[model samples]
Target: MPSQTKRKKPYSHFRLRKFLFFTVPFTILALFLLRTSSSSSSTASVSSSYTTYQPPWFGDLQTAQFPWNRLAFSLTNPPPKTLKLAVFSRKWPTGPNPGGMERHAFTLYTALARRGHRVHVFTSSLDPFLKTDKIINLKIHPHGDAESGKWRYNKAWELYQEENQKQPFDVIHSESVALPYWKAREVPNLAVTWHGIALESLHSSIYQDLIRKPGEPRLQSFNASLYSAVLPKILDEIRFFNNYAHHIAISDSCGEMLRDVYQIPEKRVHVIFNGVDENGFTSDKKLRSLFRSKLGIQENSSAIVLGAAGRLVKDKGHPLLFEAFEKLIETHSNVHLVVAGSGPWEQRYKKLGDQVTVLGSLNPNELKGFYNGIDIFVNPTLRPQGLDLTLMEAMLSGKPVMASRYPSIKRSVVVNDEFGFMFAPNVEALTTVMEVAVAEGAERLAERGRKCKEYAAEMFTASKMALAYEKLFLCIKDERFCIYP
Candidate 1:
């Protein structure tokens, strides 16, 4: 019996070893194959998404002209239906001077209000000089302390909540990040307009570096901190943006980034360009002559006045403009530069003497005069984020533009070369364009300005932008209103 047991144990051990040898190898092979399949499937899925995904509205935005005449008819001869809009803006335009986004909010909401819609604005404290008595159908709910001029989003959100409960808003609009994602996720009829996104800021940073001299310090260090800091933050923003119900990109490039890079669904993403008050900025011969006379440039003089307006910061490309204009003035005595707005570079522009006119900060009326006064508007901004309203304003004001060759400007504003000249963000490129403007003479530039005014009137007017937003708001309230022409 003992001998038989020993023999059986050895036989059992041998069988177990045989099974382990075959089964282990087979299991390992199966795992390797499964992993390879999964990796390939993931890669294919990503590639398929990029190749196959196409939004219904995807097209050349410049050519896809909105039916302004039809939109006008719809707005003027509409049924008795008006939207109750809730707007979240960090800072409302109180005084004559406001930032671009604030100006945009003011223009859009005021236009909507004039169209008989009720706009309830929840924003920071108003300026002491502002008078809101004339604004009709638009109620202001100011939160936060007025002394410090600090905006409190939480307080503004609280006010929004209270008003919402009293009479639920038909649609909610957030100007940039005034309303955070956590709150936005709960609202179905909400759309956040991204004037600029973080990825665009990354692009701006890259361009900033490119514009820098070869040996100059890079804006961002090329080190482990980039991997550990900048990229992580951008990735987090990309993830967080998905929580919003809808996105309204202010530029065509921005719209594509939201849909493709941020992975926002096509149905939830829309593109709407910024608009300016056309009436305030018009082609007036008398005004242009008067403004030029004020600037000491004779009406019959051959001197060409080139204008720039915005915060005089490095990111605004003042350094490049300063250098380029310096080189330009060294040869072309007929070219003059006019700079509006105030910042650190204000004194630097002042040092350019009579060749450059620093207007300090101008009010709305002064800005109108500034646009009319110049022969050609020049915007040498390095940051490639938001579409500068100055470009639209310049065109609408009946003047040609010489702006940077950024994608936003190239794709949206400067779609046709006849509108203006575009150059790379460098001293040599800008100087060359400026020389061309000088050579074209003021009369030829004015001819280009005429074409610019006609196009700007079609695309960049406040009425068109308002009607577009009104239609979008109506569609959000009722899907049946989402019909396209």
Candidate 2:
């Protein structure tokens, strides 16, 4: 009887272990499913428009695999002529997580499409929601899953050649110097925009400063070794920049660099400033009050809200701004700070206390609300290679800017005591700018904001930018593009 009991015990133990293993995994799976359900249901409340902004080109669902059905409209009619345009940007403007280059491509192409251009955007970015290619009147090609950049480049070049065989493109415009043409320089009428030149960007103090600090440029890390290694690459990039018959500089400073640093012929370089969507960006008294109320501010309160947005990094001069904001808040209790966007440096500067509100990342509509809620928009970027589009967005929202005194911004923005303020990118200079804003009082600030809106309306609307590009393309087509006398 004892021997029989022992055998039964071994079998019972094995059965218990099997039961426990299966139950534990099942429990975890149940919990995970429950959490996912809760999250999906919670996020379902926001409007479909807020979640996805589909461009007009993605109208036909059959040919196009739109990541989502989102729409934004502009008051413009299609052009008289149907020009086949091919835009080469690596990332498609599908979601909110767009980079500077992506935004430029998106805004420019959308404006162009509205003007009757047969546009096809070739990109190497995927839409997380929809895992397929998309094409309507305007085609979106995704080549992100390629083995390497070289492979993608080769494939894209060959594919474009094949595409052109069917229907030739009237224009070939690429982001910065990234022109991966099948025939290289033989791509008939080719043009490229300059986002930034690697050599010229090294001019910023963040890159040039000798003594190493906590937040400094990665370019200076390898020092001599790094520069020597990448010097040839930089020169090759310059060669590409010079390849295009026409070169578009997003700022005056960029144009100057092309002519001076790269020795690009003056005949090739053209400077065109960035533009903002006026209809999308606007300041409403009701929206301002609603946003302020969410921040726990009273309706009658006149606290001077200073807002800044960017991927928080050293080159952005956030450390300098944080230090200056700290000093300003100590003396003036009425001043507050609102930071938009997030990055590695966020935890480093969270000590700014209750006066600071970090909203993290925001969508286009939410961003408009944030712009309207703030009094002054500050961009303390130490190294602004291209024109910061935030400046245009803020001005569109009727907010005065207090930004770094970078060369491009200086040439681009109409910064005066009445329009806006500029400061050296440092603690002392920015602190002084805040002091001046405080001394100017509320009425003067309001008037300056009005001036900012007026200026932005005239010079920074997407419609104006599209019209410029339209004329530029026509000029390129017929050597009738240049308006300069």
Instruction: Say which candidate scores most in lDDT.
Output: 1
Model 2, range 61-82, lDDT digits (tens) per residue? 1121111111122345455456
Clashing pairs in 2: 54-70, 64-135, 79-115, 475-481
* Regions of candidate 2 where Cα sits further than 4 Å from its true position: 1-80, 128-136, 144-151, 180-184, 205-222, 229-234, 480-485
Best by TM-score: 1
lDDT of 1 by residue, 154-181 (tens): 8988899899899999999999989988
> All models: lDDT?
0.81, 0.70
Query: Per-prediction count of colliding residue pairs?
Result: 0, 4
